[model samples]
Target: MPAVTVPDLTVLPRVSAPGVAAASRPVVSITSAPSGTEGEGFPVKRAFAGVDLSVLDPFIHLDEMGEVDYAPGEPKGTPWHPHRGFETVTYIIDGIFDHQDSYGGGGSITDGDTQWMTAGSGLLHIEAPPEHLVVSGGLFHGFQLWVNLPRVDKMKAPSYQDLRSRDVALATSADGGTLLRVIAGDVAGLQGPGSTHTPMAMLHATLAPGAELDLPWRPDFNALVYVMAGDGFVGPQQAPISAGHLAVLGAGDALRISAAQRQQQRYATGLEVLVLGGQPIREPIAWAGPFVMNTRDEVVQAFEDFQAGRLGQPLPHAEVGDPVG
Candidate 1:
């Protein structure tokens, strides 16, 4: 079940969509996911959208939370904070992430669940490991992505899309080639549940030994792929990419990815990949802790609004924590 081979789904495009993608293979430019100082008690690897790597447009930032094991009684998790002018998407793969917001929204996402929260205007939120997990100890591995909001929608109302594991649809590649867990946008022939603020696709794929997938993407959109587990190859030349590396794809109509085959003497395993993309917002970016806006003054106003309790009052019973990641 490593490589999910199935009939080719490339032919099935959105009906009557204009500007059909022309057939061309894209190339991969591999880079490592950037690491950063552990913020608060949370240990995470930053993937970009910081001052160091300011290339991912429309997408502000990305973080990969521990692929490490937590010994019993060990402490870890993001604290509480306020956000405005953007959205945060949290995908929990290995543990539970309890969430509470100043907007009166609260929930816990366990394995394979995702929380897509829009912090438009403003909102205070916390993402910490469940107390039970802290007591028992276990693996805490997941991803959190920050996406920029269009200027027109920057002040839109905040909202959330809490998708359980089962809500994310899977698409198999040609002849069972690859298995894709679609979180947003279109994958193969299936659409994800997330009602996106911008056009985008957030897909997770697993490749066995020889599985492969080709995404017919819009040329105007910017795309990137991050390797999460094992090794894989991208494009026609099969450029090798090890785990924790991200490939910023070159221009073309299709993005190809395949699991690397093992040598006769080497052991084989599955490769896990996370693919992300969206139409470039192409707007001026003014960023601060938890706030992203077009102008510095707007960002300052966000902080002012928070201080004035415009975001909403925190729950008296809620735990105190920071949202720094």
Candidate 2:
């Protein structure tokens, strides 16, 4: 869970607490992610499963890639695939990954690095462990989030952003008990490095055991908190939440999270969570395998375009690896 760290949290800028008049968001629901395999059988936890789409507007899908330690020659990743009408945010907490897309947006990202790929109109891409990582496997853990674009921007040109860990906006709770890594959007006046087509905020926070973080949030944006490791309580009611759980929050100007006094031995460091929110798109969403559109007909058209080779062709060099599965 070493996405980013500070030797002393007190040295970082402190995130101001919500104003006295601000209301704390309440936990509307808590759901556990279901385990599954993706992209050539790499393990994943479907973080958004069983949650209503309307409650997650602007966020289409999320996967907790793995916390697994792989033996040598065991690392795995996705095969070449096509995507449209959305952006894919791949954040690596540990280990390495190589990405190559048809539109010349590709790079190698390792621990604490992120690759933001906007598959606006469409594109073919592949993500896989590098050759050396495959030959000498180690721990690989990360998350991939699918952010849906508004109907107007569904056909926008594709773009890519490589965000290194050092570029993230770092902050701490006023009490210096938590480390905050702002990846996108603004947090307490601290702006993250990644630019987004949609108005949203994504952050990873680690709270020391027994610490509490009362974070100011946008009243107009919907809020969500996903526990990546350790245990904690969320919302004004202090509902219990643990690793692999997602908590949907109700309208409010602030979010409340408190770490338990004791964490699982493996998570002794603290409670690790990813907090995200966005202004709801409030538009119809027609999503199918790998494609997300505002209407079923558009989704069908996407499939046709992909099949007709209009999406894109795989780079000649990608052929050196496994053929598109």
Candidate 3:
């Protein structure tokens, strides 16, 4: 990706939301995505809780991302769940994530790890609790993104991309305080580790308090940001954000973010943001729980393949789980 020269910051206009005051200078818009039934109880009810569904084109769902100070005993996570016709991208900023799948795929993802899995043609999987996280805690958080599939590949074979922290390409700012790592696609002369089946870009960025960044936009795709930690400002809206918040950006050349942290503020230590975008596919969708496909026939085909023990045939490492006991 060619580096787009950073334009000089001048006359920055600040837009305002209801609660956020628009300070006509460089500011960030921060809004809390409401949580419903999914985050009812547990150490952090909203830990796994997120904004339910995104009723938009090219975007089907968005999770505000989540975090929980692991405790002695808590509901580790979701049991065996199923997904089809779409892709799930998991990015871990800190802590550990244990995952297993009926496709014979299972492993532990550590800090700064990204797992991009495509549940094409149907697949059953479970993300077991990270027992170690229960004791140690230091920025244990991440996001799970669901990208809809185009009709052509809705029934494509399932696949996975396990990206280690080191595998991603990272670039340090000129001042050396800000770090940008492209987890997928390309940015700043760097490319992400995981190979994407779709045209997508996912990045993990950390800005030291007081640092600022201006990111270029992809004209062909819709862009958005999810705040992982810190209290900062982002975009032309200049929204003030807290941790675990999601901010969708409008179409433009590039977006801007500020890492203005105050001494007295708690959780104000710069900002952690996930920038993502992808070519939107306006295709027919058939979704049911863990299954998603272009047509009902495709969904039925996937189910029949799994029931007849044929789905696992393609994945040599797939471990067939108990028959929905």
C-alpha TM-score for every candidate: 0.86, 0.96, 0.75
Deviation from native of the Cα of residue 166 in model 3, angstroms: 0.9
Better of 1 and 2 by lDDT: 2
Q: How much does candidate 3 score in TM-score? A: 0.75
Question: Please, what is the whole-model Cα lDDT of each candidate in the order they appear?
Answer: 0.74, 0.90, 0.61
For residue 325, what is the lDDT in candidate 2? 17
Ranking by lDDT: 2, 1, 3
Per-residue lDDT tens digits for candidate 2, residues 221-295, read 999999999999999889999999999999999999999999999989989999999999999999888888999
Q: Which candidate has the highest lDDT of all? A: 2
lDDT of 3 by residue, 1-325 (tens): 1111113312212221112332222222334655532222322213222332332335555554346564455434555556667888777665666777767776887677877888777777766456655555434456666777788777788888788887777665544556677888866446778787778788877777877766555566666676667867777666776566766665555667777656225554467777777777767777655566778887777666765665544433333332110
Alpha-carbon error at 325 in model 2, in Å?
Answer: 13
As for model 3, its CA RMSD to the true structure in angstroms is 8.2
With a 3 Å backbone cut-off (N, CA, C), the pairs that clash in candidate 2 are none
Off by over 4 Å in 1: 1-22, 37-39, 49-55, 263-268, 314-325
Model 1 C-alpha lDDT per residue in residues 77-115, reported as the tens digit of each score = 655677889999999888778888877776998777889
Error of 3 at 71 (Å): 1.8
lDDT, residue 208, candidate 3: 74
Off by over 4 Å in 3: 1-31, 36-57, 130-139, 174-176, 261-264, 296-325
Q: How much lDDT does candidate 3 score?
A: 0.61
Candidate 1 global TM-score: 0.86
